[model samples]
Target chain A: MGPVPDRPATSSRTPADRPATASGPGRVLIAVYAIFAVAATSRAAVQIATRFDEAPVPYALSAFAAVVYVLATFALARTGPTWWRVALVSCSVEMTGVLVVGTLSVFDRAAFPDATVWSNFGMGYLFIPLVLPVIGLLWLRRTRPA
Target chain B: MITGYAIAVAACAAGVAIWAFVLVVLHREPEKPLLMGVGALEALLAVQVVISVVMLIGGGEPGSMLTFLAYLVGSLLVLPLGTVWALAERTRSSTAILGILCLTVPVLLLRMVEVWGGASA
Candidate 1:
């Protein structure tokens, strides 16, 4: 309700004085990540539970993508050098997963009769899966401990 | 899954989504009106959940009942959770988070409708 406080000054004063990963802009990022985490996890759960036999590869990949998103969300929310490193690794892996799975799903339509979160670079999820890790890596870089 | 109700919910969500975006553009945090709007959307979602449950119990079997129920619960959750996250810090980013939350409602609703219709057919 009060006037927006000046944030850049405080953030700049102590480069080592990094805010918690869940604070400020990071909060928004984490929220988005949390959404994806829930979405992918649930979708994977349902697919694997009910119809894993139909498309095991895509369903398993969905589960894998869910796990990665969950880890990324957790690592991004935590504070510390270790957690930061974990986030970096998780996002990198996520980037690689999306690209690889997305490409495969695109060129070999027969291979993906069922869509995973990374199918076609997450076209089903509005391409957020494709873009989220990029933003996450940038955020992690900006917030890296100095 | 009801068409009229879905449309109503989407309209409410769109109104709040725009309000949240305007707050972000103006570099303002979410204030009372915005929070109230979220609260209103939450109320609508709650109503939706109840209606959905009633329909399910009344032999309105969706194609995948578990999936439909999960989405119903998820739709009810997003606004409250997003509001808590947004209120944790009063900043433009917080407002932007609210906007994103608002936008998610319609997507969830649309998916719910798809699942419902898919089951009925």
Candidate 2:
């Protein structure tokens, strides 16, 4: 109806004065997203390189999670609506991935011989992986276009 | 690795709890003294890295030397990187970041310890 809510705040600013990083809660979210990107990427790299045969499914999932985190970090950090949509897409995917992977890993341990980023509901990573998307969604809602 | 990691973990637990109280509960940024404290922690982590490396060279290598090396290097870098990142914000958020990093370093250190201690002890 009204151009969809949560329009990006950075969209209106001139290129010269436009802020580099997201502001306030957005900044915090970006930081978390960035951390996850680094952590997941590195973990996947190690897992796949050292022991690909250990658990193909979980390792692949780890790589997937890493991509989502990377995209979310970039989207959250970039300015304008394009990046906002990117962030939303990646965050949604991340949430779904964690939920599905978390549940499956628990119900079917055989499927996950080794732990991925989303394994055990990300318990190894302090459950931050589970909580992060929920927070990201909330932050997105709050910053939605008026 | 065990001794250094134990000290690191203890320090991080204390540091993060304090910062969490200050930032989340009190809603304030860390003062100069807190920053200095982090610096102290960083020094300890540097020392840990040295100890771990020595142990590794002395024939106590982990199962995966590469991963262990990466974690060792990462743990050492956390405090300095965190301090820089937090200083830019200079707000309650920054302090929270510091706390989180502090907490993370110890966890990383613990993992490093376990990896080394588990294998070639």
Candidate 3:
């Protein structure tokens, strides 16, 4: 219920001096990434647990995407320079994952009978899965160390 | 069912309106009143969860009980989490977070309804 401790109320301290707690657009972005991590992991778990026979490739992709999302969320929420580097790497990987998975899903429909988070550029996810990484990377860039 | 659908639609519309207001008009942090409105939506979602459970108990179970339940739970979760996350920021970005979660809820709810209705029918 309290305001994020990381940010002083209208203070002029630098990002390093600020607490590591997420705030502002960072809060929103973390929320989104956290949601996706939960969603993708849960979906993959259910699919794999209940009917792994349905589509193994897509299911595995879902699990992989879920892990990336988890890492990216953590990295973005962290305040230090090391975490910033981690976020940059994860976002780049995420962007590549979406592109590769989207193109492969299109060219090789036989491999993806069921959809994964990255399938068809996250078409089932309104392409947000694809777009999120670009936005995340941009946000990181905007907040990067000078 | 009709009322639920209507409410979901209304929630989505309200979310868009709030986003517009936040991004354009207010240019301020997320106000308490608007947060209360989102709280109201969360309460409605809680009602929807209860209704869904009741419907399942009343001989309206979906084919994939597990998946259906997961979605039902997921739809219920987004609001409170979004609310808290936005509360932390209390800024336009927070409002944007609320908007995103609001938009996501209806989509998930509709999907749950579809899965439920499809299996039952």
Candidate 4:
């Protein structure tokens, strides 16, 4: 196979000329977000289908996280001012969700009968979920994909 | 997962992962060997999935068949995902998308083994 790259090499460009959010390091972010999108979606599907009545809060939250992950994945991968802002908003929501849900899950154990991706600030996920959006927002800011 | 086969897959993936990582660390473009190595590793993963499918067809049972199947299917999907990564600019970050993906297979296999051993959900 030819080693052709879709975009030209970026070694000569300054940070200010960074292309769309889906290129360069943004590709890595998309890779990770895609993983979480699948992970959270599948987890929620199983929980909701089998045991929704048992613990609706965490299950619903899992689904919500899944949607956010999906949205963020697309928003980051797609190019446009609109998608860039969508990614920004989605990452903000993700950061807030993880922190708020994480704190609540800690302070009130009874509230969350089971764990969502954001539970305990994603402690169960080795806290990658906690860190992903933080990096995502920063990446978005730094790139400011136009 | 047979202990030997698991070890083989993990070892192969480790070599590939390290190579990919070294490329990232050194800020090098993906050379022929590394991309070919990914192709080889993917073939190994495919064999692994086939083995699992055979075991299931032969009456082996995982605790949660759905989850087990999902992991199996998901494991095979890394190649397609890599296609996207490959088509992008061969930047260090772009290359790392595949490198990070190489590490997931062993984890997926480990999780599959747990499910096979009757861990649920």
Among all candidates shown, the one with the greatest DockQ: 1
Local error of candidate 4 at B41, Å? 1.3
Over the stretch B7-76, how does candidate 4's per-residue lDDT look in tens digits? Answer: 6997888778888887777776677788788888889888988888898999988989999898989888
Candidate 3 off by > 4 Å: A1-21, B1-25, B119-121
Candidate 2 residue-wise lDDT at B98 = 72
> What overall lDDT goes with each candidate model?
0.86, 0.73, 0.75, 0.83
| Per-residue lDDT value at B58 in model 2 | 87
Model 3 C-alpha lDDT per residue in residues B12-110, reported as the tens digit of each score: 546754663555244555666666777777777777778878878888757678878988788778878777767655556676677777777766776
**Which ranges in model 4 have alpha carbons more than 4 Å from their true place?**
A1-18
Best by lDDT: 1
- What would you estimate as the lDDT of candidate 4? 0.83
Which ten-residue region of model 4 chain B has the weakest summed lDDT?
B83-92
Task: Rate residue B51 of model 3 by lDDT.
Answer: 81
User: What's the i-RMS for candidate 2 in angstroms?
Assistant: 11.7
TM-score per model over all chains: 0.94, 0.85, 0.86, 0.90
Predicted structure 1: lDDT? 0.86
Per-model interface RMSD values are: 2.8, 11.7, 6.2, 5.2
lDDT over C-alpha atoms for residue B50 of model 3? 84
Task: Give the candidate number with the greatest TM-score.
Answer: 1
Candidate 2 vs candidate 3: which has greater lDDT? 3
Docking class of 1: medium
DockQ per candidate, 2 decimals: 0.56, 0.22, 0.35, 0.38
On residues B4-79, what C-alpha lDDT tens digit does candidate 1 reach at each position?
8987998899999999898887778778888888899999999888888888888886788889988998998888
lDDT score, candidate 3: 0.75
What C-alpha lDDT does candidate 2 achieve relative to the native structure?
0.73
